[model samples]
Target: MTEMSSAPTVLVGAGNMGGAMLAGWLDSDTDAGSYIIVDPSPSPTVQLLIDKHGLRHEKAAPSDVEAAIVVLAVKPQMMETALPALTGMIGDDTLCISIAAGTTVSTIQSFLGDIAVVRAMPNTPAMVGRGITGAWANAAVSPAQRDAADRMLSVTGPVEWVDEEPLIDAITAVSGSGPAYVFYLAECMAEAGRRAGLDEDIAMRLARATVSGAGELMRRSDDPAETLRKNVTSPGGTTAAALDVLMGGDAMQDLLTRAVAAAKKRAGELAG
Candidate 1:
């Protein structure tokens, strides 16, 4: 196995999600020089890292370099064109991991041909290292190769392993698309506060803080979320009044079920 710092880990895009992953790796003290970013329009966040570490950022895939790992961070729409252009980088030893939402492991293997490949679905919360990634590797991957792949992804967050390939798509529907659902809740909370006559700015501030604080509490507390939730809800009080509207007639539960189902269907469609 190659030493973690020996060979370059090529990152294929450096936009918001890509940038976040890069920052997390660096923040975790991974060798900065170990990254080679292949991005045409790298955001300022990526540029900041380049400036600090004097890291390599190539407009196209380097023909002479051998990457220990090649991370496909580009958009799914662009993968068909981009991966073909990068055919030279794939080799027997390179372990490729893709963070693109809809692209499947087989689709990646179509371009990579025979190298080890892992399909990963990570949520936006990875920006803060509070995310969980669900990943599945093709059968060609060895045990040591999978360990290396897991270590590489650990730069972002925890890894959850799966047996079959299709589960990654379900993971994409859940954790991959999960953050936006939380953000929408915050939005609605702020809007409801405004409707109840609070100032718009204050309402927004409260909603953001509450949502973030609640997540932190859940992380630290031994109590399950349901327990904490019940602790706030009184039998004949304001919290109960709010829960009556949200939980009554299975409103929140049904809405979330439909929402997740739609996301899952869309993930499959994209993979197709």
Candidate 2:
């Protein structure tokens, strides 16, 4: 188990992502006493965690204690109203990690007054401990603070750091919003299968299983995804016939490129 600082870690939200992080920290054997959950209305799962762990629960940010780290898990839309209330929890040495998408570091600093900050984008898969994070730290963050951010963010899955903050929008497009794209693919595949004469339920089941199984295979294998795709596509085989449509004239690539660009554009608009 990684040792946390003596000062408490203040969590500002207890919604899905926030609750998932709390679960991960507890499962990793972090000291329950070191956390202070500050949510007005925690979900049933979060409330159960609080009761079971005997953690300090507050309806709002407590003014009495300075936190070692404060995790901002509130929604981007709620950030303006929420951040001002938590300013007292920050100290000179405190590190603030914001997982609120499209809410820029400058926007956070506008309220918190230039403290060490790490802006992160984590996906829904975090609930299952399979998420990947893209993080960018401002100049104020020290090496130690960055390490702490990494440790905390890595609880769900791998954490990838970027030098430039604008890349976060790209990361958000590619991975943060990527899960929905995969789900859409599954939907499309299921519909196609149904049109091809399979029962709707069976088609959905097959699509779900294939997507999940393929994802698991990609996770466990050392080979690149391209290598795996080629390995499965025999000349003149069924898989090859399918790939001809997906890869032909880069049809799939062009479609995804346009999709990601649209997402990135929206992320920038949100940042503003």
- Using lDDT as the measure, the top candidate is 2
Candidate 2 ranges with C-alpha deviation above 4 Å: 1-4
Tens-digit lDDT string for candidate 2 (1-272): 23446888989999999999999888886589989999999989999999999999999999998999999999899999999998898899888999998999999999999899999999999999999999999999999889988988999999999999999999999999999999999999999999999999999999999999999999999999999999999999999999999999999999999999999999999999
Which stretch of 10 consecutive residues in model 1 shows the poorest summed lDDT? 1-10
Q: Which segments of candidate 1 are over 4 A away from where they belong?
A: 1-5
lDDT of 1: 0.85
| lDDT (0 to 1) per candidate | 0.85, 0.93
lDDT of 2 at 166: 96
TM-score per candidate, chains pooled: 0.93, 0.98
Which candidate has the highest TM-score of all? 2
Candidate 1 clash pair list: none
The per-candidate count of clashes, in order, stands at 0, 0
